[model samples]
Target: MKIISSKIVITVLLVFATVLSFAQKDFQGQAYYQTKTSLDMNFGGRQMSEEQKKQIAERMRSSLEKIFILTFNQSESFYKEEEKLEAPAQGGGNMRFRMMGAGGGEYYKNVKEGKLIQQADLYGKQFLIVDSLPKLNWDMGSESKMIGQYLCFKATAVRKVVGGTAMPFGRNNNENQVEAPTEYTVTAWYTPQIPVSQGPSDYWGLPGLILELHDNNTVILCSKIVLNPTEKEKLKVPSKGKVVTTAEYEKIAQEKEAEMRENSGGRNMGGGGRGPF
Candidate 1:
């Protein structure tokens, strides 16, 4: 009787341990975000009528607003744009609208490892930016707000703006005429209820999961959160593109943009008609 009882106890313990292991491995979360960026319509300091400004804004609406998904676990997260067909740009002009140094492709961040890997498609070439995650010193505020079902707290950080101060728009002739700000103030609203140190885009390091983030002219807000879904997202690290450090990649991008401008003779490359105003 004693031997039979020992066998039964061992079987139950093994089954419980197996179940626990699967649960730990499958624990994950998904957050959906809506992002919008504003653009300065003053092209080359050129005066334009309100009609023209309205037309320009309407044409650039698709690129200015987008939806993104962040799939994250306790120590890792992957952020990327939700897949959808983009509308064809109006008038097929030579000038193309693009977000300068914008977040493109997949961004993988491992908080535990303090590592970041981003896939960037510059011009037609691909680049994998592998570097340490940027550290932001956040000043936690007493302010609180409700984002969806979660109560969030506010935090602010000041970060130096890298690259040139170009508006998030297509290349315009008056780009050099506009003076860009050298610094940006980033504000984030995080929820300790979620208890994860992750956020959309390059914003992170908060004590909780960031639900809303504001950086300069752009805002990213969390629209939905699903914890431990039945199906899990494969949080795999991105490996495509030419491997380069963050500094090296930035230098290469700057050099290429300069080359393009020089070859185009200082003209707006995408705005083939009267110009991008």
Candidate 2:
């Protein structure tokens, strides 16, 4: 009788292990993120007429209201922007495009392997930026908030931004003019129910999925989530574009910014001229 009971217990244990394995493998999710930049381009002691401000605001509308999608599993996530068609070009116009938001690249983060792949575009060129995941020190708070149907906990962290400018390593404009070193507070609300250390763009290292986050003047909120959907494909890491390290990408981006500055006759046009991310 004892031997028979032991055999039964072993069989039950095996079945339980198999079930857990299936659950882990089958869990997947997609998060929709919308980020709005409340950036006042009137900084730097530059003032424009009301008409010029209105025109610039019209041109910056699409850039300010941006959209992103993130597909994630237990340990990995893939992020990209939803493309939009721009208006037709004006005749005999030399209008150039600048990236005004935090979206210069497509990001992939793997928490398990501690690897990251950033697909970035610079000066009409593409680059596959490979580097390690950014480590953010989060201070979990007891306060909680509701995001969609999930109960999320508030967390805060201070991130050391390279400088006042976007690109910390760019040497084009801040040479003689030394901008102050700065930092920004990042606030996020994450829920442990999903159990994935993933979020929009390059944010990660959380106890759960970050549903909403805000940093400086930019706010990224998750409006919807789809969990364990039937129509789904496997997560893939982006490999296309010239392979380079994170530092190398910064160098190339600064060079491009310098070239743009030179072309514009030492004028810092289009805000900060999209640099390394």
Candidate 3:
């Protein structure tokens, strides 16, 4: 009788272990990130009163601040902006600005398959950018810091800056142009405790989960993390867009912008241009 009882106990233990393994395999997490971009209000050597500058800054606030969410499992993740109602432009006839890159639409990454799929709505058309995951050569540093409750390690990478300019307010002249940076020095902070190689936007390839990222004038920081949440996100690759590679998409955008400029007789279009985001 004693031998029989011991065998029964062992069998139950094995069954529990098997169920736990399955649960671990399907683990999912959600991370909330707050993103902010700094604007350069230099005014191009033109003297402007402090009150005017403040008003201009207020006009740009809607495009500068945002919240995003990253839903992930072991190999698949989706990053997207959390939808919220933006305030109307403060001044009447003020043009509302939105940046084109990063946080455009849905961004999906499959680390195990080395694939990237992005859904972008550009020029009144939807485009799916199908490309390999960006190959970033991360230089892991010894520096460490705490973001929220996680201890994060520093990493750096160099990449070409994404170029786009915002139309200067109240001026159609070329002299007041604000040049986008030509190079991007990205600094990322990742926490090994999470053991997932995922980050906001196009940043990844770290040994752990990235909690903070600094790219040129923009900063993305993780504010909250929920491991194995109640509602699991179905990580589906986005499919609602015209198929195009990254280069093809960029060429199309440039051509469309040129055509708009030519049609408008080389004048700014309703104060519209890419904002710093």
Candidate 4:
């Protein structure tokens, strides 16, 4: 035949170019993240009034910008869901009592606004795949730490919170309620010389790529890390709104702050506000 059909088409094009060069060397490259979280509020049993603790730390920094959202492929994912507010009740109150109180008297006129949701599940409640592998089985020692020069290593994981069901309003009548499930202790840090294993927010399980993280007083700090560009892409996984997990989103944010203090008809309004400052 025509020279044995040109040697079977050059051995099927050299086995499809060696499987596209081993799928481009098992593709892995993409980074850029900035995660900063710090929250501490006890108000020691309400009675705030330092302008309501600066309007409960500006409504806990606008409810932590509507419960986190930051992504980037090649490693980095922190999207603990819940973000439906395209102009519904609008970014509800407490910008330090609307710019230093006295906007309409009556201690900011029985504040009870709405729309600005995000009923808890704070720091990285889910979505973590930085460098994959390590969902729990502890003992990952190596702490050489450096962060800025990228040489970090340190890992510790333990997650468990078994019971759920809480809907502090927005759906679920009968004044929703159901609790039990609180246990956490997560500490992480990673940096396989930025070979991607992302970090910052919902901190991913590390093998190489988690700048720093914490649980039990929430503290997500990755500050900065940006690399490889062409208009970034790949890093998305958000969708668990209406609260879920993280102790049923803190029991639907304490039953929506006691149903906004009984519809604000019983205002003692001290420091029962909220924040993520």
Top lDDT prediction, candidate number:
1
State the lDDT of candidate 4 residue by residue for 2-41, as single tens digits. Answer: 7545544653454454444224423433333333334433
lDDT of candidate 2?
0.71
Compute the lDDT for candidate 1. 0.72
Clashes in predicted model 4: 6
Candidate 1 residue lDDT tens string, 1-277 = 6755554465355445444433475679999988887766765445789998888878877666788899998889999989998777695245444364233667899999999998877777888889998899999876777788776779999877655555323345454544556667889999766766899876679867899988766778899988889888799788999999877876776666656765765533222111000
| Model 2 pairs in collision | none
The sequence of per-residue lDDT tens digits that candidate 3 reaches over residues 1-277 is 6755554465345445444433597798899998887755543345777888788767776666788899988788998889887676467334422354325678899999999898887756889889998898899876776787666778999876433454433235455565555556789999866777898876689977899998766788899999888878798788998999877876776666656655655444322222122
Mind giving the per-residue lDDT tens digits that candidate 2 earns over 54-135? 7766766666677888999888899888777976653423444344445557888999999999898876788998999888
Note the clash tally of each candidate. Answer: 5, 0, 0, 6
Which structure is stronger by lDDT: 1 or 4?
A: 1
Query: What is the TM-score of candidate 1?
Result: 0.81
Best by TM-score: 1
On a 0 to 100 scale, what is the lDDT of residue 187 in model 4? 79
Which candidate, 2 or 3, has the higher TM-score?
A: 2
